[model samples]
Target: MTVVNGYEQSDAEKKLNILNLPSLADEAKKIIPTGGYGYIVGGSEDEWTLAENTKAFNHAQIVHKALSNIDSPDLSTNFLGIDLKTPIMMAPTAAQGLAHSQGEKDTARGVAAVGGLMAQSTYSSTSIADTAAAGNGAPQLFQLYMSKDWDFNKSLLDEAKKAGVKGIILTVDATVDGYREEDIINNFQFPIPMPNLEKYSAGDGKGKGIGEIYASAAQKISEDDVRRIAEYTDLPVIVKGVQSPEDALRAIGAGAAAIYVSNHGGRQLNGGPASFDVLPAIAKAVNKRVPIIFDSGVRRGSHAFKALAAGADLVAFGRPVIYGLALGGAEGVQSVFEQIDHELEIIMQLAGTKTIADVKHAPLTHFNYAD
Candidate 1:
C-alpha cells in the first residue's frame, strides 16, 4: 500500500505500511477534525520556534561505523525502577478524548503493550485512576501544571502519589497561552465543562476548566511561586518545558529530581531555542545528579540517537503517538512505537551498538550554525 504522500508501505493495515513520518502525520490530520488539528499540529503565532525545533536536528548528523561487528541493539532502558524495552516514552498530552473515544486509556494500553512508560496530562479526559487501570499498572507518570489555587495543586499532587504514579513532571513551560491561528480561526475549545468560562483553554490548573485555568495562570503565577510548588511534591519531580541551562540549574537547585527539556512541541512561545540546542548545557547543569529527558521535533527513532548523543538520558515523543491514537486507538499507538523500534534497531546495528548503554559519547559531531 502507498500513503497519500506517495510512499509505499509494507502492508495495508500494519504499521509497516506507514513508510515515513509524513504518512503518520497525514493519518492524524485526517482523524482529528480541522479545528482540533489546529491546536494539535499548529505552531504558535509566527511559528519560528516550531519550525526551528525540527530544523535544529538537521544541523547534526548521526555518524555510522561501517564494520564494528554490531549485532542487535538493545533499546532497553530503566525509568523509575521499571525496565523499558525502548528508551522512548510518550509525553503528556491533554484531552485524549478530543482525539479518540478511548482517550488516555487507549494511549495507556498502547504504551503498556510496547513496554514503555507514559505521562498522563493533568487535563486528561481519563482521570488518573482510570488511566492507570487501563495500563494495568504499567509505569505511569503524572504531568502537573501548578494550579492557581495553591491548595488545588497540592491536592492533585496528593492524588498522584495516592494513585501510585511513578513520577511527577512539573510542566512549567506555559505560564501564558500562545496564539495558534488554527485554534483562533476554527474557534477550537476543549469539550469539558467550563468551570467558569465558555471556552477550552489549556493552562495552569487553578481555574475550573482548562481554558479558564490557562487564562488565569497567565496572570497569577510567578517564578517565585513555581519554586515553592517544587518544594511541595515528594515524588520524584521532573521539570518539563525547561529550555535554558540557567532554568535547568534553577530546577536542580529547587530540588527537582530530573530536568525534562522540551519546547512544548513548539506550541509555546515562538523564536525560543530548540530543546536540543540547550540539552548539553542543561545536562551539565544537573551534572549527572539526576537524569535528563528531551522532547520536541522527535519524528523518528534516529532523533532519539541524536538526543542521547547530546546527553539526554531519555527521549519522548509528543505528537507521533497522538497521531497513531487518532488513527486507530490502541492499535495505532502500538504501530507508532513499532515503527520507532524497527528504525531504532536498524540504527543501533548501523552504529555498531549492542545496547542502549553501548551508545557512547564517541562517533558523533555537533552541528554548527553560522550566525
Candidate 2:
C-alpha cells in the first residue's frame, strides 16, 4: 500500500482502498461532479449491456490446482512488442480531467508508477505530448478516433509519432457517440478543453462527413480505411472495438497488428453482448495471428484471469482507474493497479501457474450464476 498526499497511508492502505471496485465507484461519486460521475459510470440506454458486461464474468469460474510449483509467479508480458511489467494496462477513457484536475497526465504517471502501459485517448483533456511527457517516456499507446477531417487525422498520427507512442489503437466503436441516458439526464458534457485537437482546429469545423457517407449515417469507416491506417505509419496499428469474429477477421485482414475486444465498455451500443461473452470466438478467429487486448467489465483479478483464459493477450482497466483518480490522484490510481496486480498474482499462485502464458491452460468451469 502506498501513501498519497492529503490522504493518510495507514487509513487508505489498511481501510479505504481495501474495499472493492464498486465501493471505490461510490467514493468517486462523492468526489466527482454529478454529471461527470454520471458520464464515468453510465452506459447506453437501459444499461443492459453494461450490466451484462460484468455479469457475464459470473459464468466462468477458475479452477485451482494443488501440489504444483508455487515459488514465484511472473505477471509480466509483452503487448505488441512493448515489455510491460504486468499484463494489465490502462484503457483509453476520454475526458479524464472530469475525474481529476491533472487528467491524463496524472493517469500516465500512475500507470508508469505501477509498471503498466497507458493508451491515451485522442479526446483527452491533456494533449498527447503532455501526457507522454508526464509518463516520462513510459511505454504508451495512442488511441485514435477517425475524425471527419482526413488532414486532422494525419496530423494526429504525426503528433503521436512525435510523442514517441509505441503503438496506435484506432477506436472503431465510437463514430457518432452513444445515447447515454446519464449524460442526458444530468446534462453532462465534456468538462475540459481538448487541447490535442488545437493543431487541427476541429470540433466546430462543420465537417458533415457523418451523414454524407453510407446510408446517410454519419462517418463510415471502411476496411480500406483500416488498411490505410495500418499502412500509414510504421508503428503497429491495433484495431479496437472489435466485438465479433467477423470484425476480428476483417481487422486482421486489413493488416491490424492486434485486435482490441471491446464494446466501447457498453457505452456505444445499448444491447450488445459483453466483451467477455464474445472474446473466445474472436480470439479463436484470430488464431493467434495477432495479440488480443480485452476491455469492458473487468473489475477483479479473477475477471482478468477469465479474460486471459478466454484468449485475451492483455487486459485493460478503465472506470476503475478513474475511480482511483477521484479518490487520491496518481497515488490512488497506482494503488488500484497494484491491488489488482497483487490479486492476480494470488490467483496465479493458487491456480499453480508460474507465468502469464500458463494462465490460458489453467482449469476453468462455467457457472450459470455468481458464486
Clashes of 1: 3
lDDT tens digits by residue: candidate 2, 1-371: 22223311111211135466666887778767786788789898899998899889988889978999676889989887788889999999877877777778888988999789999988787888999999997999999888777788888888899999998998888777677888778755454557765665465212222122111221678778777776786888899999999999998888899999999888989888998999989988999999999999999898999899989999997999888886777887888898888889988988888999999777679768743
In order, the Cα lDDT scores of the candidates are 0.74, 0.81
lDDT of 1 by residue, 1-371 (tens): 22212211111222335676557777777656665566678888888888778778866778888888768678899765668888889999876655666778888988899999899887776777778889997898998876566566666677777778888898888877666776777766664422112222333232233345575453454446546655665577788888887888877777777889998988887888887777777777777787888898888778788888778878898687877777767877888888888887888788878887776463567667752
Clashing pairs in 2: 210-218, 210-219, 211-218
- How well does candidate 1 score on lDDT at residue 60? 74
Q: Whose TM-score is greatest here?
A: 2
